[model samples]
Target chain A: MKLKQLFKLVLINIYHNKMRTFLTTLGVIVGTATIFLVVAIGKGGEAQVNEQYSKLNVGTIIIMPAQRGKVIDPLTKKDAELFQKSKNIAAAFPILNGSGDIKYNNYSDKSSYLGIMPQYQEASNLNLLGGRFLTEEDEKKKARNAVVGFELANVLTDGSPEDILEKTIDINRRKFEVVGVLKRMGDSGSRQSVDDSAFIPYSSAERYLLGTRANPVINAQATGLETVKGAIQDITNILNENHRLGGAEQFRIMDAGSRLASAQETARTMSLLLLSVAVVVLVVSGIGIMNVMFVTVKERTKEIGTLKAIGAKKKEILGQFLAESVVISLVGGILGVILGFANLPVLKYFQLPALPSLSGVLLGLFFSVTTGIFFGFYPAWQAAELNPIDALRYE
Target chain B: MGKESKCIIDARNIVKIYQNGAEELKVLDDVSVKVMKNDFIAILGPSGSGKSTLMNVLGCLDLPTSGQYFLDGIDILTAKEDQLAEIRNKKIGFVFQKFNLLPRLNAVQNVMLPLLYRGVEEEEAVRIAKEKLKMLGLGDRLNHRPNELSGGQQQRVAIARAIVGNPPLILADEPTGNLDSKSSMEAIKIFKELNQARNTIVLITHDTEVAEQMKRVVYIKDGRLFQN
Candidate 1:
């Protein structure tokens, strides 16, 4: 028979009973739609993380200090200078974190501050709203000048950005000049929220604020993103050589790339888990298709018999039923994929990272069609194997 | 009439037995018959008389338990399933009492089915189906479904379908059994007209009146054949 005629015959049968076909296809639709949504959202999440990489500086690495037995990790000025000397390393600085009560007239607030070199501004993507950032001269002379955060500015003057500039506030019982007020970076809270903190010269924190031996964290920047791992390697070797505490390397180095990689891996695992659940649903739906097809065969026994009497071979009957099953799933798959992408715009309105991918659509189509063929075969075979004489005799 | 009178179906000692648990029910016991081209023959039998069984054997729908049966010179009893299907497609057309039309297809589409099954192109199949339907006086009802047609019209449509592919033989089972007297006569008139075109036809029924209309008559009683 001509392929087109076969298709027409199959379509006629399907159209003759619309409700049964639609109900059978619904299971596949739900399963494939869920798959589409999950993959799109996963891709969107990865895109979002990549977008944040620009602000977070993917090449930057931080060496945190903690007591590893009798000795603590030392991020000294000399160590920073040695780190900067490396060919792959761009700039390195020491971070001295301390909290002190700062008093401005009648209002006094306890605030956290990071003592750093002048390189903190560019490395942190800090927006200086007013006044100059602390210069090298401030660190050299141990000047008591501070870079106030946006939140601290609100705490100090109860006014705009300009009100907090050039204002002096007492820190740890010593007077300090507010040299800069940073603009608020609201969404980058995960990147060590700089809004509520302050920055001061490292020399002032080491000499006056923390008179005791303060173990500071070392922050290093790679010249470019490609050199990050190399920069980390060179810095680790240099730090181990400098610390010289026997065989134990005293510092732990972490980078945005590693964190991002682990985050991506977790997302992938979650998406796969969700996709597996959807696959299970699809399998159930495939079974549902099988059941419906079996019932359809039973209902159409006389028709099959008539077709045979009119010269249809067993395989032709099988092909017709199988085509019906495939058409059901294919239609459901297309609709499910559309439904998956359809939810994306709504999700995006709520700030969800959701994107439709070509691979995801193709996979959905492949899976649905495979499910159709796999589940539809046995029932169609059963129909084909029926003795035409008996089928015709069936009431 | 030499070429037109060639044998269309020849069956000898065709025995078909059905197994019911340990009991063997002989549905067709040693039945034998020969039908020639342009022969308008009827097989008359009451319920359980094995006339349907005989029809099945002649139509190549079932293989005899043991016997030789040939349709249009092909040995159907020895033919494989697919070969039987091809032979049936090329040599035989069937009309059922129920009109057996696919309810979703209109009259023209249903009539075009056999030609379509024969791999005829769509336009050619439609043309042939239309010509046959017009001859059967269903030209105005080409797009009407089976349910939309009256009993006689539906039977006419079935006749049109059976002859549309130009198969040499038409095997009809109780063709007018569901119709009123007038529709039954109309359907019988169609059978006579088709037989006039030199197409061999075998009609199965329990009605002696319907049997009398055919040019020849055969009877099945208790799975055995008697001819006149």
Candidate 2:
């Protein structure tokens, strides 16, 4: 039979039972919508992380003290010395971290203070706006030199990076000379901005503030991208040897690449799990299509006999039923794509990533259509194999 | 009738048996009949007389359990189910007692169905269907659906569909069964007119008067056929 005629017949049947077609297609719609929406969210989050990490160095690795309840000694001068001597390591800075209220003349606010050596200004990619950074002699004599981030400069000097230099700031009730101000990066309108942080000499911080603190972290730099893996091995081996650790778990070398890779893997597994749930919903929807088709065949028994008697072959009848299901799925899938795309705004409003692409639309349609065909087969076959005589006799 | 006329329907010792769970019923017992082109005949029987079963076999909607049957000289007893459909499309047209006009399709579209199944172009099928409906005095009702037409008009629409393709044989099961007496006579008159136009028609009915009006009547009773 001609495809046009078959389509016409299928159209008439669908028109005859509008509600059944809609009801059968609803499950697929929900499944497609859920899957596409979740994937978009996952993509958006990954994009956000990538944008944030782009400014920093990929060769930078952050090593914090272990949380294994063994009182893993804080990274100290001795540890920094070991790092400077380690192979594949170009620079190392032991970060003494503290958070306290700072008073600069009449301006006072809470700030994060990171104490490091003068090499940390270059090794940690700290871009300064003006003035000199902390020097090695300052750390030896324990001079209270301070460098403020853009957020701190804005608070203390009314947003002028240069005005904050040569000023005095009291940190945790101790006076410090403002030596420099860090450049602005990822600080505007974000709570997790590094621009709000303060920096002082590591020896000075250990002498007067945050003495014998636990969970101290160290920031290490590799020579270049090429020696990153070797640098990581050296850090792990050197830290293990200096701290007399037996296991590799005492200090982790969390590099930019490994961090991003782990985040991506976690997102992938989470989205896949959600997608599987959507697939399960789609499978149930497929069963719904099959059940509806079975009922449709039974209800149209006399109509099937009429068609067969009027010269329609078995295959033609089968084609008509199968086409009906495919049409249902196609409509549902299109609606699902629209629904998912429309929900992207809601995802974005919540600060989530919404990366709904054209490929996602195509995949949604493909899955829905395949589901229709695969589940509609047995019912279509049953319609084709029906005995015309018995069908005609059915009341 | 001898070989002077071309035989369109020939059944020799046709048998049809239905299998119940524990019992087998013989629906058509050695039924045999012969029909030629332009023949207007009726298979007259009471309820349970196996006339419908014989109609199914002769219509090629079924195969005989044990017998030789030929439709338009194609040995249907050996034909595959799909092949029977091909023969039915080209050689046979069927009209049911219920009129069986697809309620969704209007008059012209209903008559175009048989041709459409044969892959006829849409425009040509519609043109041919329109002409046939016009011939049946349904020119103004071409766009009227089955539900919009009266019982007689629906039956006429069904008759138009059956003969629109100009098949060699038309098998109608109680074509006037749902019509009033006046509509019944009108339907029978149309059949007579079709016969005059060289259309072979087989009417199945229990009405004796309907049987008497036909050129020949084959009476079926107790799963057997008797020529009358």
What C-alpha lDDT do the candidate models reach, one value each? 0.85, 0.85
What RMSD value applies to candidate 2? 4.0
TM-score of each: 0.81, 0.86
The deviation in Å at residue B139 for candidate 1 is: 2.0
* Residue-by-residue lDDT tens digits, candidate 1, A124-168: 888888888888999999999999888778877766646867888
Tens digits of per-residue lDDT for model 2, B63-165: 8899999888889988888888888888888989998878788899889999998889989999999999999899999999999999999999999889878
Q: Judged by TM-score, which candidate is best?
A: 2
Model 2, retained fraction of real contacts? 0.73
Q: Please report how far candidate 1 places residue A120 from its true position, in Å.
A: 4.0
DockQ for every prediction shown: 0.61, 0.68
lDDT of 1 by residue, B105-171 (tens): 9999988887776778999999999999999998899999989999899989988888888888899
Provide the DockQ value for model 2.
0.68
